[model samples]
Target: MADAPPPDATGAGKRRGGTSGKVADFRYKRPAQPEKKRRDARSGHERSGPERSGRERSGQASPLPSQMRPDAGAQSRAGSARRQAYAALDLGTNNCRLLIARPSGENFTVIDAFSRVVRLGEGLAASGRLSDVAMDRALAALHVCAEKLRRRNVHLARSVATEACRRAANGERFIERVREETGIALDIISAQEEARLAVLGCHILLEDGRDGTRGPAVIFDIGGGSTELVLIEPGGPVPRILDWMSVPWGVVSLTDSVDGPDGTAAGRAARYAAMRAIVDKSFAPFARRIAPYRDTDEGIRLLGTSGTVTTLASLHLELPQYDRRAVDGLVVPSASMRDISTRLSTMSEAERGTLPCIGDDRANLVVAGCAILESILDIWPARDLAVADRGIREGILRSLIAADAEGERSREELQRARDVTRSGASL
Candidate 1:
């Protein structure tokens, strides 16, 4: 959870500084790659095997040119120059996403990525078990993700399941089916790990030097099933994680709790407020614990990752369509965010669906997400917010690569030291 390094202000396409001295750069570009083929001709031919348990048997196919391919020779070079690639997958309450990238200098390039809204925990709030319909939807999305991973030729990858799976009694069974059908394994990560990765993934976005004195900035990730909050200190070999917690409520879970499956505007609004109140109440204990970190003199900045912030960024720009480039890492004024949240609150589901940025797929669920974001804002009251499109997946990828590189370096250094010691003993 190391604090992110300060951003390079002179870089092309960076955010502009505001009166509050917060930067609002939104210059993210989707990694350029060839258009992916919809269906693989050999997909049907792949056999299902039980070589592993829980989604590990979803046999993968050969990767396409657009996916990441590492050079083995490069990996044998010096540790810093190693050309190792890493991959991470996040199967949360709503979306199933995967990212595979090869480290390039200080930053990594996205070679291939996949995302789909599965709403796995769609009815888990009331049912206490994953609904058959929700499971089917999640499996379908996971099938596509498996195909993408196979096509991308991912070598080292970690897939994680969050609150939905953690809470459900049938979660293990669901994971088994996924492995049998899709050949992917889902590791249900702990709340602490979730918070750590959320901070790791988004830390790069909070690189303003003005907040150097803050012992640890508060980082929050609002997902479909839960919200993860982490207090992280800057300037370390790694980020120092002070505190972390996972609230049981997220957009999908809260929506299901408040409004039934068929969430309408009135239903959504009422639920939104209720959900907000619940979340506010839950935060009181954690808030009191971290009260000292809120001092402005310490320079605490709020970093948020998830649909809530990304959707807010999209609405702020009034995009004709959902564009990750425009929305990712965009900073929004607290007032502007509140205004957008207010406008969204007043709109019916149908009206919300009409908005280009929020299609029917998100009309109902987005309100829950908005309510969560608004609540966090009210609690933290930061003048500016740094939005991140990257999250658990990115964090996983970075951690894997960083760990691998460090291990390789450590091995080499140990060998060198051993040789020196042997020479001295011989003399």
Candidate 2:
């Protein structure tokens, strides 16, 4: 996906649940304000992937036109580009998410979006395979994605699988099953590629240090079975990938590594500490690798696009429900996040589940997320944690739109060359 044009605040144009799904005319909005203002707006509300057995890298999509904000009705060829809807599907270990939009000038206006937590990596760490129950759970969600793709009549789309499929022995088989059962072919992407797409998705929200540089930024994504940490260099339409590494640690994998989220608060606390210790070791090599890039002079900014950070952000704000507008571009103090993680670690499953921000589905798994979060804080220890609700889905969409723009530019250049040739012949 490419850098998004500031989104027009998305509202229900014509939303309703149907056979394909609910809410027609879905709009994925980006804030018009600078990322800082958007982050500041969150002072109130709390807010808050894939087995990739596939190691295939995502090729960049066509470049988008300068006039791409479709919700604004920018002019284009007006024949095909106007009607062509682009789509991106991300099937991760824990969830299935899809976004559909027509290229709206330089940016896209999301027409529809779907997200469901399927937890496909459930029990995979212990089993070494995707379980039948987990497969069924994921398939059901992919079916919905297929329907959205079908209903939208998507012309250009990319669907990908991440760490879960990459790790599960049965990952390839499940990909086949998805194609057979739902007609949605999923490519299992490599860890390196996963890191790239995530950077593509949310790098726009990264804040340059006070000196006005984007380098030395550590952006991470925490999924169900794996956590990806990407070190971004300054410049380019997307952040230059200086270095990246994927640890075999995420909510589902981490939670399962410990005894269940039961037992006394003291027991849970001990488990959390143990989880943190393991993560500390997992991240040590990368920490040493990135030692030179470390800088907090202008500012050390850490951005996270994952459930763990988002949930913790929501908890920090004490919001009644998870809210994207508040969470997406917001930056919170790293200390505040660590404090929230500590609090969650000390609570029982029942207590965490009851919170609107976390709820039952995430109750047990989130503590492991906290451990991962804490471990990250231990390493980067940046002043602020930037949260992005968007990830690979946005990355895929942007890539698709950029591909279109690149193609359009090629045609325009060719036409200009032909016109020049004709003029020379007349002379």
Name the candidate that leads on TM-score: 2
TM-score of each: 0.77, 0.78
lDDT of 2: 0.71
lDDT of 1: 0.67
lDDT of 2 by residue, 276-374 (tens): 898988888778877776754554668999988888888888888877667778888889998888888898888889997888878988989889988
The digit string of per-residue lDDT tens for model 1 on 180-258 reads 6666766766565676677777776766634353435668999988887777776664567776666777888877877
Worst 10 residues of 2 by lDDT: 8-17
RMSD of each: 11.5, 13.0
**Model 2 Cα shift for residue 358 (angstroms):** 0.7
Whole-model lDDT per candidate = 0.67, 0.71
Candidate 1, residue 54: lDDT: 21
TM-score of 2: 0.78
